[model samples]
Target chain A: MMSVGELLSQFGDKYLQALWTTYGLTVLCFAGALVLGIAITVMRICPIKPLQWFGDFYVQIFRNIPGAALLIVLVYALPYLRVMLSYYMCVLVAVTLIPSSFCSEYLMAGMNTIGAGQIEAARSLGMTFFQIVKNVVLPQALRSTVLQMTNLLVATMLTTALASQVPLNPADLTGIVTYINTHAVGGITAFMISAFFYAVTAVVIGQIGNRIDKKVRILR
Target chain B: MNGAHASIRDVLYDAPGPKAKRRIAFVTVISLLALAALLAAIVRRFYVTGQLDPKYWSIFLRYTTWRFIGRGLLGTLQVAAASSVLAFAAGMLLMMARVCRYRVLNAIATFIIELSRGIPTLLFIYFFFLLAPQFGLQLPSFWRITLPVSISAMGVTAEALRSGVNAVPRGQTEAAVSLGMRSASVFFKIVFPQGFRYVIPTLISEMVIVFKDTTYAYVVNYADLMQNAKVLISNYDALLAVYLVVAVIYIVINYLINKLAATVERRTRAAVAAAK
Candidate 1:
C-alpha cells in the first residue's frame, strides 16, 4: 500500500493549480464586487430619487437571497435563460453579486458615520458637490470601510468553496478536497489535511484583517 | 436666557428635506424597474428557450418536491440550532478552561480559540464533516458529519465569551472570588450573566453565521434548503421562480433572527441599567 504522505505527494501538481485558480477567481470576483458596491452605495445616497430607490431595492433583494441560491441562480438558471456563460463566469457572477450587496450596505453604514458638519463645511467653502464628496466624505468612509471590507473579503474567500458545485470542478483547493474525499482511501486524514489548509488560509486572512482594523483605529 | 428658552417647541419627527424625498423616490423607482426587468427577462427566456416548463417548479412544489424542500428546511434549522447550542456550551467550557490558572489548561484553551479565530468558519465546518466520524460520533448523514466542526464553532463562540468576560472590567470576577464563592458558582452566577450581556451582539452575529453557513452542508449531500432548491432548479423549468422563493425564505428567517437578537440586546441593556 502507498504511504499516506507519498499518496499526497502524487497529487502535488493538481493541488498547486487548484490553489492558484481558487485565489485568482476569488480576487477578481471580489474586486468587481467592490466596484458594484461603490456604485450602488453612491446611487442610494444620490440627490436623485430614482437612483436611491434602485440602490435600496438592490440591497434588500440581494440581502434576502442566500449565497448558495444566488450561486445556483447565476450558474444553473442563467444558462437556462440562454445566457451561455462558461462555468467560471457563472461562479464569478454569483460571487461578485453577493459581495456587491454587502459592500453597498457597508459603504452606506460608513457614509452615515461621517459627521454632517464636514459636508456643510465643504459646502460653505464653495467646494463643488464632487469635491466635497471626494475630499470630505470619502476619506472618512474609507477609514471605517477598510476594516469592514477586509472582514467581508475573508468571509468571501471562505465561501468560495461553494464554487465547487460548478460542473467543471476546476482544480482549486475545494475541488481538490472533493476529489480527495471521493478518490482517496485515507478518509479522515484527507479531510483533516484539507481542513488544515483551509484553517491556515483563514488564519492568514484573520490576521491581515485584524492588522488593518487596528491600523485604521490608531489613525482615527 | 431662561426667558428666551421658555417656549421650547415639541417635535415628534424630523422631516426629511425635498432632496431626501427625491432621493428615496428615485432609488425606489430604479430598484423596482431593475427587479421587473430581471423578472421579465426570466419569463421571456423561459418561454423562448423551451428547455423546461416554467410550471415544472410549481408542480414540483405541490408534490414530492415539497416534502424534500420541507425536509431540507428542517435540516437547516437542525444544524443551526445544534451548532449554536453546541457553541454556547462549548464556549462556556473553554472560557472556564482559559480562566483555570493551570498552565496546561490555559494553554489548550488559548491555542484552540486563537486558532479558530484565525481560520475561516467555512473551512472549520468542512473539516469537521470529514473528521468527526473518526471520533466515534457517527452522526447521521443528515446531521452533517465531521466532529471538529462544532468544536471549532464552539471555539469561536467560546472566545467571544472570553472577551465578554474580560470586558466585565476585571473586578467583578475578583469580587466574586473574595466573597466566599466557589469558582463554579462565581462563573455561573456573577461572571456569566454579565459576560453574556456583553457578548449577546457577537453571539447573535455568530448565530447568523451559523444559519447562513448551514447552506454549505449542501455540498456534502446533507439536503439543506439550498441543496433542495438546486435539485428543484435542475428538476424543473420554473428556474427563476423557485430561486426567488428560496431567497425570500432566507430573508424572512434572517430578519427574524436579527429581530430576536435585538430583543435580547434590549433586555440585557435594561437589566444592566437596572443593576446600576
Candidate 2:
C-alpha cells in the first residue's frame, strides 16, 4: 500500500536509467533500420534481378521468423564463431535486421505510389538514377511512409524489452521491472509506472508522426 | 505525358543493356561467393564444435522430448487461441464504441486503443501478471498471459475493423435506416458482416502476431514453446540445435497461417467479385 510518491522515490533513479537504455536502443535501432531499409528497398526495386530476388528472400525469411527466435540465434550462435558482440550491439543488430524487413516493405509501398510519370519526368530532365532517387523519389517516399515508420519506431521501442534476455545487460527497463518485482515492496506499482512511461512515449511519437504527415500532405 | 499509361516497371529503371548485364553478372557472382564463404564459416564452426553431431539431435527422438514439446505447443496454442477469441470480442466492442454517436464513448475507446497500441505487448503482460496478485484477482497463470495479449490484440483488431467499417459506403447504412429498420439491426445485419468480410485478411494476420507473442510468456515463467526450448537448453546444453528446431517450428506454423489466410483472402475476393 505504498503511496505513488513513495514508490517513485524508492526506485525512480533506476527506472530512469532503464528508460534511458530503452530510448537509446530504440533510437539506435530505428536509425540503423532506416538506412538498411532504404538500401533493401532500393535493391528490391533495382534493375538487377538477382539483387531483387535477394531482397525479397531476405524480407520473407526475416519476417516469417519470430523476433525472439532470431534474437536467440544471433546472441547465442554468433558467439561460437568468435564474433561476440556487446549486449547493446547484439540487441541493436537483431532489432535492426528484423524490423528493416517490414520497413523496406513499407518504403516499397510508398515508392509504388509514386507515378511512373514522375520518374520519366526526372529522366527527361537528364537526372541520373542516383540523383532522381535522392532528389525526387526518396523525399516523397519517406513522407508517404512517415506514419508506418512511426509505428515501427514504437514497436522497436517495445521490442527493446526483449533485450532483457541478453545476459550481459540486466539494467534495461524490463530487467529493472523484473528486479523491482523481486526486490522491492511496491513492485506492481513500479511496473505500472514503467508502463506509463512507455505509453506516454508512444502517444507522443504518434502525435509527432501525425503532425509530420499532415504537414507533408499540405506541402503536396 | 499521361502517367496512366506507364506501369510500376517503367518507374523502376530502364532495361539493362549488354554492358549493364555484364556488370550485374559480375556483381552477382561476387555476392554469391561472399555469401558462400560466410555459410562455409558457419558450417565449419559447427563442425568443429561437434554441433553437427547426430548425438545432439538424437534427443528429439526420445518420447520424453516429444511429450515436453507437445505440451509446450499445446500451451502456446491454448494461449493464442483463447486470447484471439477474447481479443476479437473486445475489438468488436471497441469498434462499436468508437463508431457510436456518443462523444464520450468514442473518446474512451480511442484512448484505450491508443494506450494499448502504444504500450508494448511485453509491458502489458508484465503489468497484468504483477497486478493480478495485488488486486487479489487470483487469476490462473494462463490468464496472466492471455489477458495482456488480448488487450493488445483488441487495439489492433479495433483499428482494422474500424477501417473496414469506414471503407463501407455510408449510403448502405443510410438506406437501411430509411427502410424503417432499427439502427441496431442495421448495424448488426448490414454493417458488421460486410465490414468483417473486408477485414478477414487483416484479422488472420493479427492472429499470427498473437501466436508469435505467446513466446513472451517465457519471461513470466510460463511453459510456452519458447520457454520449453529454454528448459531443453538447460538440460542438453545444445543451445544452437534447440533454438534452430524451435525457430523452424515457428516458421512452419507461421507459413501455414499465412497460406491459409491467403486462400481465405482469395476466396473472399472471388466471392466479392461474384457479388458485383
Candidate 3:
C-alpha cells in the first residue's frame, strides 16, 4: 500500500493525463449527444407519425439499456454482425446514445413548458413553421434546459468511466485508478485522488450551471 | 382548452388547414416507406453477415435457457430491492438531518450528499472492491456491489425526499405546532407521511436508476442477470444472440418499472386533486 504523498509523486503525471483524457471524452461525447438529441427531439415533435414513432422507439431503447450492456454489445456483439468499431468509438457511441435519450427527454420537458397559446400567437404574426420553431420553440427549450444539460455534462463524464472496460491508449480517470491498482498497490489513496478530481469537476460544473440557470430561467 | 396535459406536440403546430393536411399525409406516407426500407436494409445486413442463422438464435427455444435467465433476473431483483431499501433509509435520515436545526449535522450531511452525488458509482465500487481490502475490510461480492450502489443512489434520493418535504405547505407544520405537538412527533406523524406520499412516484422512478446501477454487479463477479448472461454466452458460444436478448430483457424490465411509476404518478395526482 502506497502512502498518499508517495502515490501522488509516483503517479502524478498519470493522474494529470487521466484527467485530460476524461475531460476530452466528456466534451466529445456531450457534443455528440446534444446534436443527436436535438435531431431526435425534432423527430419526436414533428407531425409525421412514423418519424415520431422512430424517435420514441430510439429514446426508449437507449434510455432503458444499461451502459455496461450497451458497451458490451457495441464492443463484442456488433463484430458478429460485421459492424466493427474501434474500442474508443464503441465507448463513444455507447456513452452518446444513452445521454442523447435523456437530453431529448429534458428538451421535450422544456418545450412542453412553452404554452400552445404562444404557438398560436406566433402563427397569428404569420411566422413560417421553421421560423416559429427557430424563434420561439428552440430558444425557450434551450434556455430552460441549461441546468439539465449541465447535469448531463457531469453524467457524461461519469459515463466515460465505461472507458475503463475497454483498453484505450491513454486511459480516462476511472481507467487510471484501475491501472494503478493493478500495477502497484496504490490502495485507497489511488481511489481517493481520482475521486477528488471527479468531485471537484462536478462542483465546478454545478456552480457554473447555477449561475447560467439563474440568468436564463423563465419565471413562469 | 387550458389543460394540464398540454405537451410540445400540441404547441409545435396549429390544426392543419386543407393543404397542410395533404402535405402531412404525403410526408407520413413517405416516412412510412423510408422506415420500412430502413428495416429491410438491416435485415439484409443480417442475412449477408449470416447473423440470421438459426444456430445463433435457437438456444432461446429451449425452456431451460429461460429458466437460467429468469434465475439471473431474480438475482438482479434481489440486489435492486435490497439497495433500494438501504438507499431509501439513508436518504430519509439525510433529509431529516438536512432540515433539522443542527448546524454541524447539517454540514456533515450536506457534504456526504454532495460527495455521493458528485462522484460516480464506479468510483465507489472501486473504493469497496480495491481499497477496502487493503484496510482489512473484506466485504462479500454481494455487499461489494450493493453498498456502493446504495451509497451512489442515497444522495439523489435525499434530494428528492427534501423536495417533497419542501412541497409540504408550511401551514401544515405550523398547524401541527399550534396543536401542541412536539417537533419530532409532528414530523414523523404528520409532515413526513404526507411528504412521503408526495414523492412516491419519484422514489419509484429512482428505483429504475437503482436497478440500472445493479448492472454493475458484473465487476464484483456477482451473479446478476448480466453475469449469468455471460455464463450462457460461454456455454452456448452465442455472443450476439445472448447479449442482445439480455439487453432486451433489461430494457423491458425497466420499461415496465417506468410505466408503473407513471401510473402511480397519475393516480396520485388525481387523488391529490380530488382531495383539494
For model 2, report DockQ: 0.51
* Runs with alpha carbons beyond 4 Å of true place in candidate 2: A121-129, A167-170, A218-220, B1-11, B58-68, B262-276
lDDT of 1: 0.69
Model 3: runs farther than 4 Å from truth? Answer: B1-6
The list of candidate 1 runs beyond 4 A from truth reads A1-5, A218-220, B1-54, B57-68, B114-138, B145-152, B174-184, B227-240, B263-276
Ranked by TM-score, the better of candidates 1 and 2 is: 2
For candidate 1, lDDT tens digit of each residue in B15-60?
4468757865776777668878987886687788773564654565
- Interface RMSDs of all predictions? 7.6, 3.3, 1.5
On residues B11-63, what C-alpha lDDT tens digit does candidate 2 reach at each position? 75677679878987888887777767877987998888778898778898899
Report how far residue B143 has shifted in candidate 1, in Å: 2.7
Chain A agreement with the truth for model 1, given as TM-score: 0.90
Candidate order by decreasing TM-score: 3, 2, 1
- lDDT, candidate 2, at A199: 86
Model 2 TM-score, 2 decimals: 0.90
Q: Give the number of the best model, judged by DockQ.
A: 3
After best superposition, candidate 3 residue A84: deviation in angstroms?
1.4
TM-score of each: 0.80, 0.90, 0.97
